[model samples]
Target: MKQEDTIDFHIKRTWQSIAKMYNEEASKYDATMATGYVLLNIDKEEGTPSTSLGPKMGMEATSLSRILKNMEERGLIERRKNPIDGRSVLVHLTDLGLEKRADAKQAVVRFNEAIFSAVPEQKLEIFFEVISKVNELITNRKIYLKEV
Candidate 1:
């Protein structure tokens, strides 16, 4: 089969396109798509636990650490000792972070609105279902199995 006809190829290509679009938009604010994603995941009010951030975002420890370090240097986030757990840390957004978070939120909302507006509701539902099944199959390691 042609590579363009494969499900994984389409999925990967679409994701790459979306990431590029998001990164271009984020550049205006001196942020990358990765940083914007992290900003959105962080809780605005109570702050998020440092260890939880990586898992929540499906990000690697090394990459998350570098992004967090850059954000801290830019005064976007502050790491404070976790009161509940002495060994862990809590990541809190500063005033600047809050502002950037709002910007990121708006960008996400706009993107969703544009897509949802263009796509039919029924088509969108089917798309979501297909994506969910793909995720489930991958999670369960069901792909590439030989038939009985």
Candidate 2:
């Protein structure tokens, strides 16, 4: 089949578009799309653990480290001793981080609202189902018979 006819192609293309839109918005705050996502994933009240942040965000250690470093340098996040886990550190949002997190949350909420307003609920449900099924196929390793 042609590239445009493939589901993966559509998924990748749509995601790229969405990432670009988010990046553009994030640029105004001197942040990137990844940073906005990270801010949103973090717990506002109780800080998130440094170890958990990577897996929670599906990011590798090196990349997460870079983002955390940049945020720290910008005074957005501060690493504090994890009371619960003595060995690990917790990444808590500073005052500036809290403000940026709110901005990120608003951007995500507005985007979802816009999508809901534009797309029919039933159609959106079907779209979600299709995406879920695709994920399941990949998770089950059913897309390929042998390791390439």
Candidate 3:
């Protein structure tokens, strides 16, 4: 096969591997990346509306609501009526949520270390640059904007 075809094949396999890994560790992912994102966003905007939260987390309204629900049940977040907009609700992190967020931060550091350790140190930067370029191309798809 051509070099381009080989690259494409490996890319597909790499993504499949990533998906499988996430599926296997689904529970750990939520409390780490999911919680970390919410915590960071909350730190930036302490009482953000659920509507805005979805965009920050790259999630749809339904998905964000589900995540919020799980976090709420875990005592990681709290919702209250927005005083400025009675019809809308705002999300805030409780003390427990902040503590969990701290833990999640550490978990992410360890997780990333384990993942990146496989890459040869000299090639790691180039690998990430390629990943970034691919992500940019994917995210800039005109068809996606049309759908939204």
Candidate 4:
């Protein structure tokens, strides 16, 4: 096989692996759950705008907006006019949103730790470096979550 084909094969395989992992945890991996998870990080200090959510989630604006509307109706989150900028809207997590965020965070932590614990300690640093280099070369965005 050609080098390009080999790379594509690996990429597809990698995605499948991740998706399978997510499927195994599907009850916790719903997009709505993620929306709530993301909401937990928002507050008066962060003051995240609803529009910024799409870029953060790698979703289209329309999809994010629809999800946001549903969340709003469910009372998980609330949007208010930004005090600093009238044009911007800030998203705040309601009490229930915060609870969901905490649960989602614990699930993510447990899942990721399970995956990382299987890796050899000595190779972990180099593994991250290699992935980071590949991401840097192909896309300007960062590869893994770094707590924003």
Candidate 5:
């Protein structure tokens, strides 16, 4: 089969395109796609737990820690002990982080709006259904190769 006709190829290419677009927008605010994603996952008022952030963002612990460290150095976030758990920490956005978060939110909104405007409602629904099925299949390991 042609690469363009493969489901994985299309999924990967679409994601790469979306990541590039987000990275381009994030560069304006001195952030990367990952950083902006992390910023968005954080709670504006209560803050997010350090452990929860990685899982919620689908990021590795090490990658999340490095991003958090960079954000702290840039005055975008602050870490404090979780009130209920002495062994855990909570990540709260600084005022500057809030500003960046707003920007990131806007970028996301605009991107979604652009896509929504271009795609018909029915097609969009089907697209989401397909994506959900794909995710379910992957989660269940249904795509594994069979022995010859």
Candidate 6:
């Protein structure tokens, strides 16, 4: 089968387009797609644990560490001692980070609104169902089982 006709091909292509669009918007504020994502995942009130930030964002610790470092350098985030857990740090957004996070949130909201407006409700529901099932299959190790 041609690559263009594959399921993953379309998924990846769509994701790349979305990522590119988000990155372009983020660049105006000197941020990147990952940074915006991190900002969004962080708890605005109590702060998020550093250890849990990666899992929340589906990111690796090392990769997240680098991003967190850059964010710190930019004064977008601050790492504080976790009051509940001394061994772990909590990531809190600085004022600048909060502003950027608002921008990121608006961008996401706009994208979702656009997609929702463009697609029929029933089709969007089916698309979500298919995507959920795809995730379920992967999580259950059902995608690559050995032949009987």
Q: Each prediction's TM-score against the native? A: 0.96, 0.95, 0.64, 0.74, 0.95, 0.97
User: 91-135 in candidate 4: lDDT tens per residue?
Assistant: 887787777667666767887798689988778888788767887
lDDT of 1 by residue, 1-148 (tens): 9998899899999999999999999999999999999999988888999899999999999999999999999999999988888798889999999999999999999999999999999999999999999999998989888889
The full ranking of all candidates by TM-score, starting with the best, is: 6, 1, 5, 2, 4, 3
- Provide the lowest-lDDT 10-residue window in model 2: 139-148
Clash-forming residue pairs, model 2: none
**Per-residue lDDT of candidate 6, residues 27-99 (tens digit):** 9988899999999999999999999999888899999999999999999999999998799899999999999
Measured with C-alpha atoms, the lDDT of residue 78 in candidate 1 is 97
Specify the highest-TM-score model's number. Answer: 6
Clashes of each: 0, 0, 0, 0, 0, 0
Query: Which is the winner by lDDT between candidate 2 and candidate 6?
Result: 6
Give stretches of model 5 more than 4 Å off. 145-148
Worst 10 residues of 5 by lDDT: 139-148
lDDT of each: 0.95, 0.94, 0.73, 0.71, 0.94, 0.95
Q: Can you tell me which runs of candidate 3 are displaced by over 4 Å?
A: 1-41, 81-88, 116-118, 142-148
User: In order, what is each prediction's RMSD in angstroms?
Assistant: 1.5, 1.7, 5.1, 6.8, 1.6, 1.0
User: What is the per-residue lDDT of model 2 for residues 1-148, given as tens digits with 9 covering 90 to 100?
Assistant: 8999998899999999999999999999999999998898889999999899999988999999999999999999999999987999999999999999999999999999999999999999999999999999998999987867
